[model samples]
Target chain A: MAEPTPSLAPARPPTGPRVWNNPRARAIIYQVLVLGGVIGAAAYLIDNTLTNLAERSIRSGFSFIWHEAGFAISEALIDYQPNHSYVRAFIAGLLNTLKVGLLGIVLVTILGIIIGIARLSTNWLVARLASVYVETFRNVPLLLQLYLWYSLLTEMLPGGRDALSLFTAFYLNKSGLMYPVPVYDGIHPFMIVAFLIGCVGAYAWGRYATRRHEATGVPTPRFWPSVGFVLGLPLVVWLIGGAPTAIDVPQMERFRFVGGWHVSIEFIALLLGLVVYTGAFVAETVRAGILSVSRGQTEAALSLGLRRGLVLRLVLLPQALRVIMPPLTSQYLNLMKNSSLAVAIGYPDLVAVANTTLNQTGQAIEAIAVIMAVYLTISLAISGFMNWYNKRVALVER
Target chain B: MINLAERRAASGPVIQMAGVNKWYGEFHVLKNINLEVRSGERVVVCGPSGSGKSTMIRCINRLEEHQKGRIVVDGIELIADLKQIDAVRREIGMVFQHFNLFPHMTVLENLTLAPMWVRNTPRKEAEDAAMAYLERVKIPEQAHKFPGQLSGGQQQRVAIARSLCMKPKIMLFDEPTSALDPEMIKEVLDVMIELAQGGMTMICVTHEMGFARTVADSMVFMDGGEIVEKAPPTEFFKNPKSERTKLFLSQILH
Candidate 1:
């Protein structure tokens, strides 16, 4: 038999019409036209707005950001006075927003996972309760829930003078929650350092235990020992420092409580509303993610003599996480944005502070732009992190 | 290898099921199944679809609960006790039609997971055992690859190796080759033949009559959730006494 020669010659390109009539050329032209239209529209809007501002004799610039903000904020994490600049007010509002957002994300995740697992519980009552929670919270609007919480906190609680007391150290009233705080002492910083060291020690111990278990067949006790290292070390340090027993507890004064740390009812209401509402959606996401894993995976693991808990931790969760991450990221972003509704309840989040600044300075455009930029940055950061995590958990396949 | 007859005589029945009955909701799936499988014995269960063959073996490991019956595996009674179920499961390995290999893990990891976690074997020991099994199955080079990266035949062989890593006394196969292509079926059957020749007690539910003839010491024909006939493969093939058995054999064989 004769060997067939391989064809190595390159095929000739299609001899078609001129560049103007070519398909690729038309595609490029169409894309350029669309791009130009979008840019032209944006430039027109900006020019029109600037011309209108000048004609109305309205000063439009970001210089107003440095001017004095002669307004009282309801709450502030950092020091802020009416004499402070608008920049300081904006920072306070941003901090408030971040405080609620970060805490809400953590609490909602924990609650969502618990409720999600509970929804699948064989016990009828627990499953029913979880479903009810998801349905009720997710069905109602978030703003309404915030309003309801705010009203309940402000109207139902007793007056500051007759605040409800818990163990004579914490006070709850319409004014806010007042809790005891430790008095500053030189030993306190040392105690914190000791606590940090204990944390590092616990982490190192956990790693070592895992390595030892893998190297040797014998397993070591991990949970309790790590706990002892973290908490026991702090306790030892406290004892060694002759633990200062001086704590400033709240006391009823002429009008309100004095001393101790105070938490505003607005902040509490905002956090409660955000967490409860977002937690319901997160629960559904969790349930769906878990259900996405096939029953065969569970049966295979069980057949291998692994316990149900081990099957869930090792096999089910790793697969379920891939399905859960994308939706969970959007849920987090939604929670952050929905936090803007805090303005309705007077929590003074970014939107609320920006609203005040715009009303005072007549720089609605700049204020709104700043608000948009901040939200855009937060949303992108969250999505970027979730994407990275999703990739890590994704399955490898041909 | 030890003589099969001597090995069988040395040990009593490893799996015993008497008056086993099961139901799925309102439907009766298995009704009064009574069987005994001695050590080093290979029982091939062949039947029409929905004949309760899969359900019967699933009951041996307590994967499917029997509503009313006594199933004692290795002297451990199958009951609501979790410890007992886990104990019996450790001695029994099961392979499914879909291969059910954990896609998230490599072939080596899948084989090593149960031994390292349940048996508390060290990582090095588990990997060594896994590599040996992979070599026995003739796919040692694919150890680091994921299950999804392998062919159907290779995946099935890996699944078999995974079961063997646990060093179980008995292995259950439910349609192990039914899901594979015609070309891939022989590779899986060859592995099973090798395993059978090694004196492993196996209960395989399959439609591959040639494999049954080659390896199965006993043949069981089930119809309508009951074993219609049980006999030696030579006797069962040459002269099926029951009408249902004759009909099933003719349908499958021709």
Candidate 2:
């Protein structure tokens, strides 16, 4: 068989210039054009703002940051006076913000997890109650909730003289909560040290028990013994220190209570608002995350003879966390930013303090820039940590 | 390889189901099913789709709660109490059609998890036994790789090894080879056949009739939420007693 005679095709047409036809070259040109446009626009805006400031004789710089802040802040986490510089005032505001933000994060997480699991409870009443809480809190606007709490605390509570008393040491009224604080004593430091040692000892015992269980195939009781090491050791130290009992309790002095530690109503209202609002969203996130795991995984774990708690810890949580981390990070960031609404209720958070500074110094651009930068930095840090955690818990799929 | 007399003399029935009935919402999934599995006997359950065969076996380990009747395994009854269910599950190992291996863990970790946590076995001992099971399944080298990295056949075998690592007294296979490719079915079935030869009591739900004829002491045909016919493999295939079983056999065997 003679292989059919070879056939030739017609010659190809010439192509256009490579620069315009090439995808990579075109992409580079488009990126350069966009960058140039952005830089030009930014330069123009900067020059225009500076010229306008000069024309109006407005002093524009960060020099105002060094000058003394003359206004009084309602709440300060750190030592602050009207004579303090703007830098110190801002530091106090930042500290206050951090206090509420950290506390709110912890409280909301615990509340959210409880509500999320409760929503999945077998009891109809528990699930219905959880659903009601989530719906009621998340549907109302956060600012409105803050206002509601502020009004409730200020208008409904009795005067400080008629404050509601708990054991005669803790008092609650329009002035917020007043409680007893332990007086500084030499033995206090020893007790704290003993507690720290007790914590470390309990942790060590847990580790040793796990090691023993692995080595011998015999499990040991962990809960009660660890509790003993943690609480018993501290009690022993307290007894050795002669058990000093000096406390500074708040007492009514004319119109207001004096002594002890007092939390302002503004701070309480803001914290309650942030926690209650963010908790509802966090609960939904948790519920969705747990539901994302297939039912087959749970059945498989149960078939392996693992009890309910062990199955949740060993199989369910590890899988659910991968789905939970990203959205949970968003909720944390939201809570932190939502705390800025503290200004509406007159709480001294970062944005509230910066607003005061801007009004006093007439440096709108600088004050706003500082506020934006602070929020951006904290938000990035939270997301970075969550990303690392998510990576650790993620599945190894091909 | 027939050691029927020796196995029959080993012990009484290890699994007993009397008047077992189950429902899903208003749908009756299992209806008054009664069965007994003796020690060291291999029984294969075959059925058409939606026949409740899987649900029947699932109730053996209390994965699916039976609305009525009693299922006693290894002397403990399956009940609403978690303790009894856990006790029953410890003695029974089940293989799923989808091979539900923990995807986050490697093959070795998957095999060792139940033994170490549930049985309270030491980590080293559990790992040693896991490796041995992996060797038996002929995938010792794949122990370090995750389930997602393995082929369907290899993953199924790893799952079998995971079950065997616990040294369960009774093994339940629920459509073990149904999800596998035609070329890979024989690999899993070969391991199961070897397990049968070692005189393990097994209840497998599979459509692989050749495997049933080779290893099963009895063949059970279920249809419409009930066991329509059950007999020895030779008699069940050669002479089916019920019309449903005959129709199912004719359709499936072809």
> Which portions of model 1 miss their true places by more than 4 Å?
A1-21
Candidate 2 deviation (Cα RMSD): 2.2
> Which sections of candidate 2 miss by over 4 Å?
A1-15, A193-206, A220-236
- In the range B1-254, model 2's lDDT, one tens digit per residue, is 56687768778999999999988999999999999999998999999999999999999998888999989898998888988898888888889999999988888889988998889999899999999999999999998998999999999999899888878999999999999999999999999999999989999999999999999999988988998887999999999999988999999897
Residue range A137-178, candidate 2, lDDT tens digits: 999999999999999989999986999999999999997899
**Kept native contacts, fraction for each prediction:** 0.67, 0.69
| Number of the top TM-score candidate | 2
True-contact fraction for model 2?
0.69
Q: Estimate each model's TM-score.
A: 0.94, 0.95
Best by lDDT: 1
State the TM-score for model 2: 0.95
Determine the iRMS, in angstroms, of model 1.
1.3
